[model samples]
Target: MSELLLNHLAGRPQAGSGPGTALSDPVLGTELARVDATGLDLREGFAFVREQAGAALRAMTYAQRAALLASIVKVLQANRDRYFEISTANSGTVKNDTAIDVDGGIYTLGFYAKLGAGLGERRHLLDGEAVALARDGSFQSQHLLVPTRGVALFINAFNFPAWGLWEKAGPALLSGVPVIVKPATATAWLTQRMVMDVIDAGILPAGALSVVCGSSAGLLDALQPFDVVSFTGSADTAAILRSHPAIVRGATRINIEADSVNSALLLPGEAPGSDAFELLVKEAAREMTQKAGQKCTAIRRIFVPEALYGAAAEAISARLAKTTVGNPRNEGVRMGSLVSRAQLAAVREGLAMLQRHAQVLHEGAAHALVDADPAVACCVGPTLLGARDPDSTRAVHDVEVFGPVATLLPYRDAAHALALVRRGQGSLVCSVYGSDPAALGAAARELADSHGRVHVVAPEVAASHTGHGNVMPQSLHGGPGRAGGGEELGGARALNFYHRRAAVQAGAGVQSTLA
Candidate 1:
């Protein structure tokens, strides 16, 4: 591998004043690059974004900003191949997995671009229909949504440097807010490359987009009152960010996507050999193996009918057995390594803790990884676990082992399943598979309060439904409670996060213009 030295984007590519840290290939354990942020002037960078980039972006109308997003889409598409290569090398993901990050990011940007165009030439947005204050309708009150005159600081996770950065950036840029991304140090290479490419294309104004790819020492300290911070990582880190003075004292806006023990439910009355049963098995296994099960939305606990507990466990384990783990470069490798040895160790540690309360249905430890050295390669196959009595198991409900690991639990009925599902405290998503529409709808409604999204899959919509863990641009993401009481990505609604709302009481003539 070539030795790469990544530079931060502060209006342009620049080196740090502190010593840099080396990055290594997760699968091969070889040094790949270095990112230095020891003495980065993040406060100065924020000033540049708020003044230079902010002014230029705000000068453009919604439609003009949409055009810029469209240009970014084209640039990403043109360089998609290079991005896939970087993701595979640095993140240790297969082609299909890499597409979820690279292609997903492009698609999200495109979605926002088209969405922005629909808003026309407006610099601000109207929340709803204007309300009449006077009985004669002469005075009116209208809610106006205007972009905050501040910057957006994105602290992305290791599992999705590509999509994580773009997903947040899409809405922020569309809302006329500038962004500075701080990718997870483990997988900063891909994020840096993409940011570099976009800036090089000159599609965005200087200071409109920036990236700091090393120690996030001064990043939080640089926040202003109007600035927004969106973070995706552990709940512990989210708590730390929430307690920071910028958010607590200054009342700065913040959104967090943290640890979630999401679930997949097989509603009662579905026979072991039935279509719904099979579909649930397929989806549960897929969620466990996709991205090596590093996704926050991935299924950690699976609930099924008490009668089919043993059968369900057997079927899911059989499917997981077919997943071949190895390097992404290999032709038939269905599953790839974790992002790094540190991640692998963390997953193993968490898994071990959960094992005390559950029995292993299928251990991936014995599964030999193909075309890679077991000593150096950070590879692990899919493992299916079973909790004979889920109500008695605390770790199965509270702990999240972020790897290709999942535990099957049994429930007596729909009510029982819902109770068990809620044991997660809160989650990003919960998928229910069944043939009964009314029952499925009821389940979804009940799950909605605790989950950010509830995917209901009947046989008719099975093939068309996006996977349980996939976060779509048109739907809501993030959840309440342990999943983080945050919200994002529901079409134009996402733009609200980057904007401030105010109710304007004005005359009929002034309100008519807003209407």
Candidate 2:
């Protein structure tokens, strides 16, 4: 990694006056960069965006704004190799996994650019037909979604440094709002680097994009009435953000995508040796191993029929044993290390709590790592545990280990499986696997009540269905209760966050000339 400065978009590189924080490569324990953003004042930063960047973005037609994003996509794609290399080193993800962060960001920008062109050249969006406010039709009202003059603040998670920024920035820019991104301190190197590249491209207007690398000391305090803040992290942090004075007083809009205990259920009646069984086991193991199970959408609970409990455990364990954990650059390393040693320790604590209600089915020995030293590198093997009494085990459904760890529980019948699924309270996603459409459909319908997405993998779609851990751009990436009850990346619906909706009531002739 190269030495880079945090881009404040304040005309020049931000002066490093604050305490310098070091960003490290988890796999090699090497320093990547020193980040500090102390000299910039949040109040002035936001004021500059409102008067400068926000003005430029809002003045442009929707088509012109969309074209800017399209140009950004070109710039990022032109330098994808560098971005992929950085992601692998900083995030400790394998080659295939790094693509999700680097390539996924480019794809999201492309999708939003095309979407903006389709939105036309209108300045304000009209919601449905104008309604007659008076009986004589002298007065009418039309709902409008207008761009907010305030800035959009993004507090991202550590797991996805690239995708997290682009996904939020795409909609905010299209909606005519400036953005100030504050990535998680532990993994802010990639995000800061990307922000610098965007600034250098000069595709978007000046002051349109900025990033704070180390501390967000006064950012939230500088928020105005029209501003919006989006956060992705733990549920505990979400609760604190929700209760902030700005959010509580309706001065700013807040959106959160918190961590949850997501589950994957194998419906009853599928034979132990059938394709459905194999597919279910493969999906569970893949989700557990992907990104070292650091994803928010990773499966934490696996529910299987009572008859197939032993078989499911054996199959998943066998697949997990084939995984090789080490440095991400090594070809033999199927899975890489955790983001840092601190994260690995947190996972260990969570696993200890979960073991009180379950027994280890597949324990990864510290000495079994390939091409790596477990003491120096932050690596955790694909560990599996089995909960014998599903109904009595509260921690199995409530606790989230947040690493390459998953607990398998046995369900007696259809009702038992549904109960286990609902015990997660609310989840981002849940998958159902079986040959019977009738049973899968029933289970999906019930699971949808608690989960934001219910993925049904039947025999016909088993070969083509996306796995349980993948979050698509077109689908809503959030859920009901514990998952934060927030929605993001659901196509054009995300634009609503960067806009302000209002009902414009006026006479027919006046309404036509309002804009």
Candidate 3:
């Protein structure tokens, strides 16, 4: 049996298992108890989530709830080191990179806490004024944002177990709804630790947050119309879940944030020998290596002016060659391992497909690392490929090497570049590199219909740009079409996903009759 699977089976606690032993994984460096079968049963889990939503709403006033949220932030800060350790062990992220995930996640919680406070204070506005005496001498009209009685089931991807969960939970919790999180097994340990912290803080109601490890099993089968489901993972799985009979027959509300072949474009004015050329290389390299290229938002396609195709290839290759790959714990280790060996294999498969339509400019598949275990962990060197033809299936689209991999496609013109990017159908993000405002605006508008978010990066804006791989709390995280037809963050936009909006009204004489 695989080490991961063996560890999973061994970690299952007996009914009488002692406290620490019941939930501890010596290999993974974390203690997380598996949910009792009774607690994890779909029906019971649903009931628990629903009841917690009510209790969470009743336990505190708006101010008190906001205060509880603030307390969560403090707790997360104090436990930051512990969480980072868990992240590194389970997800292969270095402490520095993992720290960003923890910090950003904490910020998300804090943002929603403030949002909850704001909503509570402003809810009175939603309570529309009761107009005095209608013609029949009766009060009339009212409006409010009430919580949905159903639960929220969040099925998350392996890349971001912590951030993804809180991103969904923060909004739902603030909106007075309960959430059930199912983290990917490979990195479930990190999520378990964070959730335990929340539970121990005594901020959330008992049932406000519950977690399920291992397979989803019967979770989706019993969903109701009032329940809300959100997912972040591959497109194929999203399709399967979306087409489930229960989801389709009962019309359950579902949101998906899947993977996509995202791209970036360099304008004609930026030849390879120019400053713009160097900037493009740096940007693409960063996208390929940061988070070990695990981000769903990373730029998978690089479109360069055909005249400077060779220059662009060399520039990117040179940058990638210099990147150091090893254990994230080691100093100066710029790139780390993929989340797991399975993920490394998946990325290799993606590169194999790209070989048909592109030429590899740089290969880091074989390298001697100073200190890291390849068997227990896996790391792919950064790879850069040049598309044989912009219009080819493997050139601008139809492939995504999830690890530190990128393809450079040469476009005949701006129009052709836009066409190549659009072939991917829809994506989470597309970035354009150029100093000309007209060029940036033109490319952005042309590709606007094809991408959910477009970021313009030029020498002028480069200083302030957050780069291509990071997604902020206030921004929408999902893309269109193949990327998943759903979004995760967007402040109140995410909160509304857990709620059902119904326009309630009564007959004009109803109010008079009641009085």
Candidate 4:
């Protein structure tokens, strides 16, 4: 055992068994920490958050909560270097990937802080404008939005422990809801440390924010009617969470971001070596390799013109070939290992299933680890598989291998490509690359119903376009159908999740007073 990372209950550390679940570095296989919530009354935690922290936060205005968020940003910034060091040891990530989780979190918190400042001193939100309930001047109606009286429980994925916690917390805190985060066990170290830093700062009220680091056995059962649960993980797990008795009984609000086979489509007008073609290739390769393709929005299916399929495959493979995978601290290493050995095994198994229907264009398994032992290191290079007859392969469309892996599919034309992309059921994002504005607009409109966001990339914006898989704080980050019919991160719209709406019908004078 290295260190016992206790669960933070009501801003106090709750110690568990001396030896708990061991967390190790994926690359070096050295124990980093342990987490256990052996004997804590979770139901009391829910009550503490609602009665204590929730009351304290609700007493403050939006601007006051925003100021608190700003103070947290400063605290996180002061300890950023230490966070980076821990990310390398626990997350097996280099500087760039760690920045996405750490700095990205701080950035989101700061953005929400500035946005909340504009909301002023209002403790509750008004929805739209007041309307007449009757023809007479004496009657009126106004829709009101008030913060829920319970907590927000976040069940996050292992890939983004930091960004996952803050992005959701920023809006919930602003909405006057306390938060309890149960980070995925694999990468709980960084999440635990970040919470430790915040608690040490003493800026937040006790129970305003808490982290449960061990098993999530009884957390869901403690939910009250006003409580909300936001989860990020595989579709299977999302389905399981949905069927939990509390959620099934409508005693809690649930939001999910599940498996998505997101795509990148190169429009038919673009030919080989053109700007659109090159941009698609670059983005596809980057999405496949960044964070070791563990991102929920990573481009898993690449759609290009049938005539230019070979060119796209060769170009993307060239990029993946240059990426070196090993221990994140090593020089010249462009990518790091999977979060754990279990994840590595899962990716390999999924790849084998997809290979039954597709050819391996780039065999990442053949690549050797640069600075870590092959047997101990949980490493895998970027892989590009090609499904020549994509229309016939079910696994290529349905299975999401959460690693540095992607499958290239050839489309006959724009319509053909759209049909193939829809086979993904639904996704978080899909980028259509082309040079024509009219064509790109048409494609984007067609994809709007299936994808939360349709990123249209052209020659003009290629230089400035954010990469395909990068989830920005200012845009919608969830999708419909298999991707989970939940929404998040669309500016102030995200605050709606923490609010309860009601139509207040009253006399004109009363309505005016309430407003």
* Clash counts for the predictions, in order: 0, 0, 0, 0
Residue 440, candidate 4: alpha-carbon lDDT: 92
1-515 per-residue lDDT for model 3 (tens digits): 11221111111221212122222322233433443222234675577567655565545555566667788889888998888877766676776668657787888989888877776543212434445445763545544456677778889988787788888888777666677787776677777668767776777776677676666777797577777899888888989998997688988889898878888888877755666677778889888888788888888999888888888888888888888887777777777778766787798887888777677788876555536655545777888888757774544477677888888888888888888888887999998888888988988898877787888887876678877767777777777788887877776676667656543355556533322
lDDT of 3 at 136: 65
* CA error at residue 73 for candidate 3, angstroms: 1.2
TM-score (all chains, Cα) for each model: 0.98, 0.96, 0.87, 0.99
Which candidate model has the greater TM-score, 1 or 3?
A: 1
lDDT of 2 by residue, 274-384 (tens): 988988899999999999999999999999988898999999999999999988889988898889878989998998998888999998653277777777788889889
| Model 3 poorest 10 in a row by lDDT | 2-11
Query: On residues 1-515, what C-alpha lDDT tens digit does candidate 1 reach at each position?
Result: 34445554558677876567777788888888888876666778889899889888988999999999999999999999999988988999999999999999999999999999999989999999889999999998999999999999999999998999899999999999999999999999999988888888989999898888888888889999999999999999999999999999999999999989999999988998799999999999999999999998999999999899999999998899889999899999999999999998998898889888899999989688988999999898888888878888988889988899999999987898999999999999999999999999999999999999999988998789999999999999999999988888999889999999999999989888885
lDDT score at residue 202, model 4, on the 0-100 scale: 95
Cα error, candidate 4, residue 189 (Å): 0.6
lDDT of 3 at 117: 79
User: How do the residues 302-331 of candidate 4 rate in per-residue lDDT, one tens digit apiece?
Assistant: 999899889998999998888988989997
Model 1: lowest-lDDT 10 consecutive positions = 1-10
The TM-score that candidate 1 achieves is 0.98
Whole-model lDDT values for every prediction: 0.91, 0.86, 0.72, 0.91
Name the candidate, 2 or 3, with the larger lDDT value: 2
Better of 3 and 4 by lDDT: 4
Model 2 steric clash total: 0
